[model samples]
Structures are given as structure tokens and as C-alpha cells.
Target: MALPKAHRLKSRHDFQAVFREGIRRHSSHFTLRALKPAVATEPSLDTASPTANYASTKIGISISTKVSKRAVVRNLIKRRITAAFYQLLPKLAPGWRLVVIVKPTAAESKCGSQQFLQELEQLLAQAEVLNGHS
Candidate 1:
């Protein structure tokens, strides 16, 4: 299963914003970009709760053709990365925008899902975006 809509970053603008404003955390196979949500100066009347709109973390995955010429191979990498994110979702802090970009070296590596999970967790921790990482 894929990440829920609320947790997935689909807009090109959102991706660009994160790329422009987010901090970068690197690993051998992935480069993580994380942007903390902007502080709301005033509570909006449109929502009953002040924090309702920014209560979930949003993520995007980018795998370039340079990583793999074949769609199947690139898709497999994406799926593995997505699965790793799914497992770590609950531990991630809310109100953050994140993008996971796969490195070209990843395509030639023989790493598995577990390795992806470890690298992702390490990156998030380094970025201080994981819960309890303050």
C-alpha cells in the first residue's frame, strides 16, 4: 500500500519549496531534504483547531532516469524507499515537508529494504526531524 494522500507531497510547487528552503541530509543511497513548517502568526477561523492544517508530515520521492534507464528498476527502488518511509512514518514529527531523492549509485548497489530503512532513519535523525530528536 502507498502513503495516504495527506502524507504524500504531490504538487510541483511544494517540491520546489522544499528544495529551495529545506536542509539537506545525505546518505550513500539517498539525499533527504527537510523543511520545517512555518510558524502561524495567527490562528485561522477557517479551522476549528489551530494546528489542524499542519498536523501531518508530507513527503515526496524522486528517482531519476539516471538512476536506472528501465522504468521497472526505478520503480522498484521507489517502492523500497516508500516502504521504508511507511514504517518510519509514525516516528516522524509532524509539520515537516520532506523529499527523498535517490542517488545514481543506488541503482548499482545491492542494498535491500532494510538498508534503505536504516539509511532513511539515519538521515531523518541527522536532520532532527524524528520524534524525540529535539
Candidate 2:
């Protein structure tokens, strides 16, 4: 079964966790940033844990209405982000919650599934989220 909307953790938790833990994230900023620390300092770390069993990655979306109040564009961005997760998370470890902050730039990127996958590939490589690929 997949995780429901209310159940996933958005990337802001990373910012909060990083702030609270006194750790800095090794990040990849695409108008947005992916900040990561070596170890988590809060209970949420349990969510980002990497184990052997299959697990659904928790995702967060922070697309501001200022970017586009239209539901269609917002939904499209959400769908794109979700699609990115499904394609990339398997190549990563299990049980990690990722926060994806969308900038207005994402509203213009015409990336396909493979492009999105490649973006994720680069992201994981930078965040050290990949398995052996890391």
C-alpha cells in the first residue's frame, strides 16, 4: 500500500530538523535546495531511516499559490513531483521522507519522465541518497 497525502513529510521538515539538530544539509539547490545532514537530531529521523524492507518514501510539496493560484497548474506540478518520486525513490534507500520545494522555475521546465528521473539521479547522488550509486 502507498502512503496517503496526510501521511507524508514535506522537505521543510528537513529545514526544521536541520535547524533543531544543529546540522547542515548537504544540499542541491534548483532555485530550491535539498539540505541534508549526516545524522538526524529528531524523531523524524526515523522516517528517513534506511533499512532492508520495502518502504514508501514520504514526500513534501511547497508550491506556493503565488507561483500560480490555478488549481490545474498546481496539480500538474504536484503530479510532476509525485511522478519524480515514484521514479527515483526506488533507486534510493527505504523509509526516507523528502521535502521538495518548488520554485517558479519548475513551472517552466519541460522535463519528461526520463529527464525527471535523471534530475532525481543527480539529486540522490548529491544528497547521498542512492544505494551503491551514492
Candidate 3:
């Protein structure tokens, strides 16, 4: 379950209402964008096939078996990511569903927690989420 809304992005429909749609680069940072027609309407709403757009992004995290294998570790990653989101949402514009995929290093290393957070901070910064922190 998600933590109580720092401010709910609510549903994908709600996300569509404001989707600043961005993508994770090869570098793993998100790029910010304005709403496009593709970003605004659900495939069902759009009368089109459900082909995910690449130029845009959804914050989806992957905590793989390689990363944790343990349910508890995966849950920890989720909590960490959500906490980061709560702290950053004020600065994030609307219409994004963040999916944070956890790396193996995220759970196996002693310093993984700090590294995970730093990587998150980097991604959020690249996405411009902190540009308007308030």
C-alpha cells in the first residue's frame, strides 16, 4: 500500500490530467516534459492500442530477485522510494506515475540504502522535481 498521500497523483486518469511526462535516460535520470496528447488520454480513452510511449516516463522501480529476493528487502526499497517521493512531490509537477526499479546493489551492499537515495536524488534532480521545492 502507498503511504498516505503527500499529495495523491491519484489515478492514471488524474495523472493524465497533468502528466509532465518524462523518461529515464540511459543514465537513469528522468527528463521532464510537458503534456502531450499521448500523455493526456488513456489508451482506452484514446481509441488506440496500448503502446507505451518512450519519450515520456512513468516512475516504475524494479526490485529484482537479483536485488533482494527477499520480500522484506523489496518492501524496504518501496518504502525508501515512496519516502523520497513524499519529500519531493511538492516540487514535482503533476501527471507522473513514478516507478522506481531497485538495482541488485540496492539491497546487497552494506551502503546500498545511501546509494539508492543518492541515485534517487540524482534522478529527481534531473527530472527537475527539486527546481521548485517549496
Candidate 4:
């Protein structure tokens, strides 16, 4: 199943803002970057409620060619990461922009699901981006 629209970070500007202003947390397999959402000067026409948009969280995942030359491998990594995020969704705090970048070592080593979940959880915790004690 696909992630909700509110959870997927789709725009270049949003990605840029997160990358530029976000706090970084590193793990063995990946790096997590996150920034609290900023107030928008203008409301988007696509969404009926600006408050809802502002209150939701968004995420972006990146698996570069440097990590894996094969598209299949990169996609597999993305799927793993997305699946982990899906499981962690409820625990994540809202109104934050988050990005996860897969590292070269992770692609080369072919890390397992357990490792992925652990690394992601640890990174998010260190970043202080998760809600409660996740």
C-alpha cells in the first residue's frame, strides 16, 4: 500500500528546505534529516484546509546510484525503508519534514529488515523526531 499524501514529501522546495534547515542524525545504514514545518505565507489551493496541511508530517527517501548501480537494488532499499516508516508512522510526531538517505555501505551489504528498523528507530530517536518513547 502507498503512504498517505500527507506523509509523502513530493515537492522540490520542501525537500530543499528540509535539507537546508533540518537537523541530521546518522546511523550505520542510513542518515535521517528532519526539520519542523514552517508557517506558509500562502495557502495551497489543492488542499481544502491549510491547518490540516500544516499539521501533517511529510517524508522523502533517497537511494542514490552511488549506493547501488542497479535500479532493482535501489528500489528494494526504498521499499524496505518505506515499509519501516509505515510501521513507525503512528509513533512519529506530526508537522515535521523528514528525509532518509540510504548509505553506500547499506546497499553493498544488503542489510536485513530487522537492521533497517533498528537503525531507523535509533536515528529518529536521536533526532528527537519521534513522539513519546518509540
How many residue pairs collide in each prediction? 0, 4, 12, 0
Q: Give candidates' CA RMSD values in order.
A: 1.8, 6.3, 8.7, 3.8
Model 3: what TM-score?
A: 0.53
Residue range 36-103, candidate 1, lDDT tens digits: 97777786666667676457999999999999999999999999998999999999999999999999
Tens digit of per-residue lDDT, candidate 2, span 43-101: 45465545423455455666787667787987777776667666665576654545556
* lDDT against the true structure, each candidate: 0.92, 0.55, 0.51, 0.85
Better model by TM-score, 1 or 3? 1
lDDT of 3 by residue, 1-134 (tens): 45455344346564444433445432232222323224535345644644444322334444567776689877877677766655555465444455454556556555544555566667666655444632
Query: Which candidate achieves the best TM-score against the true structure?
Result: 1
Q: TM-score for each prediction?
A: 0.91, 0.60, 0.53, 0.86
List runs of model 3 lying over 4 Å from the truth.
Answer: 5-22, 26-60, 112-115, 132-134
Rank order (by TM-score, best first): 1, 4, 2, 3
**Model 2 lowest lDDT segment of ten:** 23-32
Question: How high a TM-score does candidate 4 get?
Answer: 0.86
Which ranking of candidates, highest lDDT first? Answer: 1, 4, 2, 3
Index of the highest-lDDT prediction: 1
Clashing pairs in 1: none
Tens digits of per-residue lDDT for model 4, 25-91: 8988898889976666676675666576347778899778999899999988888888888888888
